[model samples]
Target: MSSPAHAIYSSTLSLSLQGHAFHPQYGVQLIFNEIAESLILCGAICSQNPSCRTFDYDSSSHRCRLFEADLTNGAIIAAASQTSIVGSVILSASLYASMYNQSCSACQENRYQTCSSTTNTCQCPGNSYWNGSMCPLQLFENAACSQIDACRSDLNLSCIINSYGGFTQCLIGINLFTIFVYENTKIVQIETMSDYASLRSNDGVVSPNYNFLFDENILE
Candidate 1:
């Protein structure tokens, strides 16, 4: 009878290897070896494993390193041709177990809402009434000014008088009552109600009792 023929196991770098297992998600592979067969086997293992991000193979030891996360490629390995053939299969069941556990946990609540990580928090916009991330309850309440008239300067009431050559006064409807004149002060006290009414009404009539002479030559 002929000697039993040796079964040659084909190696591949693709993720479709038979009987290969890996994380369920988010995995890749990095290859570091120059050997064609080793590269092929590493790729095949990673292809079969869903969560294997990459694979690293040391040619010096014919060792295959598998990672469940991202890996750096193009790592140089010397004396790769002299290394002995080691076992083909190496498995780590707890690969990336800690990462999965941490990602699944909930973060603490942020009071200011400014936490930008996976945690949900409340943050305030710029120029808002509140100083911090959260808006205050009494922000912008009972403001001193309104949108229509901020300073309350538009009173709309004015006064005109016949004295001092038809002088006009701006009557600002505020708490104070005052008057101003451009000329020198000339006192003419009104003792009767008729004199006061004539000055107040601005009817263009000068009272005879309060008459004062002015020099005509002063105009020139």
Candidate 2:
């Protein structure tokens, strides 16, 4: 079967940036007596069952394995086989509260997180934030981040493109890193402080290390 174009996530958060998302070296040892045609189908089947936290789908044999472990410490990402698909259950807000009743009884998460018997939700108790795998002390400024939801909202942070355009980081507001007004031939030298330093704590003005002569149109 073909994978679905979109998804409705779930509460089974097997996310761990520190390492593989979940499963021990022995792996998520329990295989559900279930089979799925695709990875998405395995997740869909997990969504229907409240006790499921993560699933591994083997495309070669169509095996849908499930897990219910204390995720205080997160796991790394790897496949039992090249054809295996692994994932956690990160549900959406709309369907979130519905998963309050039933979930895994085992709490393998780190000290910062706790499993609420009544709500069936594992949560970080204080200022610490959950970074997919385990709860960290705090979210720092300029930290590498992939999603806006992963950043600390109380600090009014957003994930934006970085200077090199290679990765994203948590910066204040929707601030664009830098802008170069490319002129066709005019080489207007900017004898000014560094452009990006404005957002830094020491105020806007920082010394430039070196200057580059513009030669965008010049041929070899």
Candidate 3:
């Protein structure tokens, strides 16, 4: 009969070991119905593969966990031993590290513009305006104003007008009593008043019974 193979013992899990090996590491032990054979196979696998850092075998389910590198001590160990084999695999580094390239530049050039590394946006020229992902329109300078004017239309107030300005001005009498300048030229003024009463009263100077009385509340 052949002698049983002795398990290889090491202070830490072997980085090259995978699957079943000839023996478990120093702190590690195989708990399987066929512990001797399982340990031998795992040790052999780990020795052959450089990427295989560590491995675990479940006796119950006959499953194996191959790790690219050893994690923390308790992290790779199973919480409970069961009849089924259950295992977990760990890569050499975090999975995301492998997915993204850290050395790549931040900005990329497109057809319309060159993207900025700091702002992560396309750079548009001074005369160009950005439209969505591309620069579409060029900007131009605006014309200056030409001339302005001022005038008066009604009783006690003055009116001012603008030549090249966008708006017009006019004076308006409130309640036929006080004269106030209204900037917009849309309203029309009809008759004049001596005082606020003549302005607010129903009878104007054209009426025979016109009585001009200055009401103090009008000033208030």
Candidate 4:
């Protein structure tokens, strides 16, 4: 149906945590039937049910659980063979039509504003190099990043540990191999502290080597 001129609806489809599952206590159980066949179907069910907000699907079990709200009270822990489906409503066919026609001037009004088809409004686009409040600029080496995905991955950019002990910038990762060698003492220890560790990359920053630490408790 056609909405009012310039009418905006806001919603988004999030696949960011697709492979993970939400905690059981977070969402309300609306239904647990064979009717919920797939994640797509679960989303549709949520849309149909006005009270539904989020849903979780067990791919292996083919079980679907719809929630009246999102993950607010509990943590969304990762689960094997589970997929979480979160969707927003604020979309209309008219918005898609407008985007296709290129009649959307919302983006042109400002350099930071991009047409959000789901919301039918002009807002910052995803992965546009986040600014303080809005993402108007592209991220460069050493630029602050809230999450790993916030930085450009196509350029082999990685959000790793900074000297400050916090993830703040995007830097190129250095590849290093840790081979076990028998020294005169015959003791095996991980070591990357060498003069070669200070090699400069395109960003003129020292590449950090990461070594995997073995934990005996993990075997349990």
Off by over 4 Å in 4: 1-11, 24-35, 82-220
How big is the RMSD of model 4?
17.3
Would you give me the overall lDDT of model 4?
0.41
lDDT of 3 by residue, 1-220 (tens): 1121211121123332232332323232233222424644655454334334455665545555444333322243333554322232322222222212121232122112333343333343222223222332221112121101111112222222233222233333323232332223422233242232222222211232332222224221
Candidate 4, residues 1-220: lDDT per residue as tens digits? 2133322222333543566655544222333335466767765565545334456666667677655334432345677764544343332333332332132464443222355464444443443432223332234456676433344454555454443434567665532223232334443332232211111111122223322232222110
List the candidate numbers ranked by TM-score, top first.
2, 4, 3, 1
Per-candidate TM vs. native? 0.19, 0.32, 0.21, 0.31
lDDT, candidate 1, at 112: 15
User: In model 2, what is the error at residue 172, expressed in angstroms?
Assistant: 47
Better-scoring candidate (TM-score), 1 or 2: 2
Q: Looking at model 4, report the run of 10 residues with the lowest lDDT sum.
A: 195-204
Q: Write one digit per residue (lDDT tens) for candidate 2, span 23-67.
A: 533332343747788867877776555445556677788877775
lDDT per residue, candidate 1, 1-220, as tens digits? Answer: 1121210121223332332323212212222333435745655554444334445544454456555332122222232344432212222322222221122221122111122233122222111112112222111212232111112122322222233423234233322222221224555444332233234224222333344332222110
Clash count of each predicted structure: 20, 20, 23, 2
The TM-score measured for candidate 2 stands at: 0.32
Candidate number of the best lDDT:
2
